[model samples]
Target: MTERIVVVGAALLDGGRLLAARRSAPPELAGRWELPGGKVEKGEAPEAALVRELREELGVEAETVERVPGEWPLRSPYILQVWTARLRPGSPAARPLQDHDALRWLTPDDIWDVDWLDQDVPAVRETLTRFPTETR
Candidate 1:
């Protein structure tokens, strides 16, 4: 079988909150919420791809803080990996200028408030575990 494509998702953190974006494309996924990220270029590293994706999708520069510790499979030919990320020192705050129509910073107790895309549930669940106990 052919190797699957890798897609990276960012659990962008600011203080004790995680970022979430609302999709606006590809009919089926429209209206669903997900971590903001995109496909990894063939020769690129997943962390690099995540930084690139956050910039492209949110109009902000970010740095990968750490990997979220597990992988989730998408439909054939694609697998999703998540990483913790934070905005760069002088970068602007994230703005939804592409693919996504909206953005929100979610507290640990509010993690279940968004209607996350089905394929992203596993990664989201894993991310919640990384939040500090005081925040939950």
Candidate 2:
């Protein structure tokens, strides 16, 4: 059986930019940039897992707008579910929790500058394609 792993993440458009996180430790590719979410717990639904992760990682509430419609395999052997979400009215300020060192709001061109987890790269690329940066 393929060991299944689910990553719950958000594509928050803050001021028309997407949010990303810099990871800290333990998880092998620590210093790389990643979407602000985590592994889905056993028996938890992926959408619910995303909401929980956003609240835990970023101190915000999110509502799923859509699932990105594909899976990307990680080097560590888990397939990722990239979900798109919208911020809810009562969302709290984002604060680093768990293994994230910092957070950033990035435009499409600037996204490639941050080191991303291998699996997430495709999803991020797909997202950028869908929501291109407005050229100034």
Candidate 3:
């Protein structure tokens, strides 16, 4: 079997809200909501890559909380892994500086409000399990 490359996605939460980003490029994925993050580079830890990707893509300093416990297949040679994350103290507010065109912070009650990318739906449902529904 061919080795799969890891793409780390951040389930960034604040005030019990999950952050979702809308893709603007790579025509096929455009307009679909997803947890914002990017590919893990060779020899880099997945958690570390997620932090770096957030800085580049969202312009926020964040730290990973925990792995979300499963992987999903993306397009050829890429697999999706997610980590719950939060903005570091004093970090700037997240903005769609790159890769994304817009961002939304969805409450647990409204998490389904966005039109998520098909592949992201399963991963998102899994992430929700980590949170207490009573919180947000």
Score candidate 3 by lDDT. 0.93
| Model 1 TM-score, all chains together | 0.96
Listed in order, each prediction's TM-score against the native is 0.96, 0.87, 0.96
- Candidate 3 lDDT tens digits, 1-136: 9999999999998888899999998899899999999999999999999999999999999999999989999998999999999999999989998879999999888999999998899989998887767774
Clashes of each: 0, 0, 0
lDDT of every predicted structure (CA atoms): 0.93, 0.78, 0.93
Model 2 global lDDT (CA atoms, 0 to 1): 0.78
Residue 26 lDDT, candidate 1, scale 0-100? 80
Q: Write model 1 residue lDDT over 1-136, tens digit each, in one string.
A: 9899999999998889999999999889999999999999989999999999998999999999889988999988999999999888899988998899999999988888999999899999999888878898
In candidate 3, position 39 carries an lDDT of 98
User: Ten-residue segment with the worst summed lDDT in candidate 2?
Assistant: 127-136
RMSD of each: 0.9, 2.2, 1.0
